[model samples]
Target: MKKYIIAGLLAWLPLAITVWVLRWVINLLESVFDVLVQGAAAILPLSTHDVLHQLVEIPGVGVAILLSLLLLTGIFVTNFVGQWSLRQWDALVSRIPIVKSIYTSVKQVSDTLFSSSGQAFREAVLVPYPHAGSLTIAFVTGRPSGTVAEHLDGEYVSLYVPTTPNPTSGFFLMMRRADVIPLAMSVDEALKYIISMGVVAPTAEGLASAPQTTRPAGL
Candidate 1:
């Protein structure tokens, strides 16, 4: 009975979460359309206002319009004038006290996660972290640099150790390249492992083959 229950949950939990996320996004888009219609009703003729409100209320129209707007924005941002305008806005944000550090850190993380060339959190690695007796999965963010790099021994990699079930927060460590064991698993597989709290491990054939023997300290 317990095995069956676990299997059933494994089948339905992902679907439930996906549906929940989609519903939340759709509701948010609908609210945006509703606000636009309500705001326009303040100044427009009654007949035109009713028409716009009815159109906005149609199911899925808000999502369609939102996607179209995003497409248009993407096109605009790729052009020279739009790039210049965005740079000026970023510069203004940088001049604001306290806001610049928060904004810059978020922007850099986003770029590293989403951009084609950025290397942050790209590789899955296995390391003896927190202690020699235990192994932890970590993501290779990149090699450390500047003053931190100077302190680390030759060829150290910067990586993050995410906690089970909640991956958004985790520890950042700079481990020696020789000490860190690079995993064969992709970033997505590693995430699934962490999120499922070790319940879902890929078959050995699916994982990368690597030397996993841990050495004692001072050896």
Candidate 2:
């Protein structure tokens, strides 16, 4: 009975979580749409108030508008004028005291994670963690640089050791390149493994492709 119950839960859990997330997002978008409609009704002529109110009655309008805005913004930013304007905008924001500090930090991290040329979180690796007896999965973010690199004796890479079930919060460590073992699993597969708390594992093909390393004495 317990085994059957567990099996049933495994079948429905993912669907339930997915539905919950979608519902949350739809609710948020609808709320934003309501606000926009209300704001427009307040500023526009009384004649246009009915039209704005009617828009609020339509479902998914907010999501559609949000997507359209994002698409238009992407198109705009690709142009030379838009690029220059973006730089100017960044410069303006960067001059503000506390806001600049927060904005700059987030921007740097976003660029590093999302940029086409950036190496952050590109490869999954296995490394000794907590102790030499234990190994954990980590993502190779990049190499250490600047003053931090000056004190290091050899080539070292920065890694992110994501905790099980919550990849967002993790420990950052710098380890020698020679010590970390590269894995054959893709980032997506690695993430699934981590988020499932090792219940989901890489396929046999992926494990077969991983480079074989000689185990130290008892390990």
The best candidate by TM-score is 2
Model 2 residue 210 CA deviation in Å: 5.1
What is the number of backbone collisions in each predicted candidate, taken in the order shown? 0, 0
**Regions of model 2 farther than 4 Å from truth:** 1-5, 31-50, 208-219
- What TM-score would every model get versus the actual structure? 0.77, 0.86
Write candidate 2's Cα lDDT for 1-219 as tens digits. 999999999899999999999999999988987888888888899999887777778888788987898799988988999989999999999999999999999999998999889999999988889788898889999999999999999889999999988999999999987778887888999999999898898897655434455332334
Clashes of 1: 0
Residue pairs clashing in model 1 are none
Q: What is the C-alpha lDDT of each candidate?
A: 0.84, 0.87
Q: Write the per-residue lDDT of candidate 1 for residues 128-162, one digit (tens) a residue.
A: 87887788889989888999887876788888999
Judge candidate 2 at residue 214 and give its lDDT: 30
The whole-model C-alpha lDDT of candidate 1 against the native structure comes to 0.84
